[model samples]
Target: MVSIKEGNSPDTETLILEAARKVFIRKGYDGARMQEIADEAGINKALLHYYFRSKEKLFDQIFLAAFKDFWPSIKSELEQGDGSVKCLIRAGVNAYTDMLMKTPYLPAFVVSEINRSPERMEGLLQASGVDAAFVMAVVQRGIDRGEVLPMDPRSLLINMLGLVLFPFISRPVLSRLFFDSEEAFMSFVGQRRQEVYAFMCRAVLHSSAL
Candidate 1:
């Protein structure tokens, strides 16, 4: 896990995007300022503006970068294996949890922006190459083979996502309320990769598959 502030090997655009991602995760869309991103990247605001014209454009680029970084590997993982419903769930949970652990603020940032500007985010998501229908089809195939219980693919998808997302999104309250320290909270979150996998199995797997 390289620090966002790693070696000066990255170009100026890469620096701005990494800096903007940190700022956006900390301050969110409306709250973030271009100057703050420049300061984070140790560049002048004029230079930052030279690269990205506006905060909206910067935010979009950051989200797109995250989606690009995330979706491809997970897509490969989902495409592999026995193509079982449980396998799909396992791959998704494991991949998402691992990514969230590395960038814990990502889910909250994405969710916040979507609520703030769903139309814009929808366009961005459409560009992200997340094949939801393919994932749903995996579940449908499992049901067709009598491997999982008959369930609405959409509902099952939402169920799996909710299980993976809730803890990270609710981090502030959950960290304080349920755990003594950030370390404890993160330890629990690390464990959730397996926990979520087991929970999804119980939620969707048929008796024989279980």
Candidate 2:
């Protein structure tokens, strides 16, 4: 969420956000402290409180921004009939992988919260105005048009979510077991973006579509 371009001086709010993101990535929601974030930003606690009254509000702001950055504008794409289902799949997977590369700890943080309180986050997607029926209808149209295999939209969506999230969820164990170093693990993740797109294409797209 720290979107300041190279060589630009970040404003105080931007600095705070960047510092909070780093602290959240390191300590997670429960472990992160407001004072820690202020220290990370090289600012005093009073100033931090003036900008963000509470830890929850600050964390919510950062997490929500990250989520928005993570999700593609597929709703608009489908509405405009801008791309085939396969194309959308590829774009979505690419976007997801790229976002994870930038915010590697996000999936773990979300999964931890969901495990702690399932009801707390159950309505997030709905609250975001992502209509399940509308997305299903779009997928159904792809099936009717033979752009993809005749699979249930729910199954396709769940599978895509699993495929995209599993790597990040298991990164701690997988990184230790499969990679020699942090750089190697990151390199593998970078390569897996294309692999995920290709795999999903095979899983859902018709031969002609591929």
Best by TM-score: 1
Cα RMSD (angstroms) for every candidate in the order listed? 5.0, 5.4
The TM-score values for the models, in the order shown, are 0.88, 0.79
Error of 2 at 147 (Å): 3.5
Q: What is the lDDT of residue 42 in candidate 2?
A: 95
In terms of lDDT, the poorest run of 10 residues in model 2 is: 72-81
Name the regions of candidate 2 deviating beyond 4 angstroms.
1-10, 75-82, 131-134, 207-209
Which candidate should be chosen as best, given lDDT against the real structure? Answer: 1
Candidate 1 residue-wise lDDT, 1-210, digit = tens: 545564443578788888998998898888988889999999989977677777777787887876565543566786778898878888888788878878787777777877887777567767986567788788889989999998888888899888888888899999999999999999999988888898889878998998
Cα-based lDDT for every prediction: 0.81, 0.76
Instruction: Give the per-residue lDDT digits (tens) of candidate 2, residues 34-86.
Output: 88999999988876777877888888787666555545555544445555777
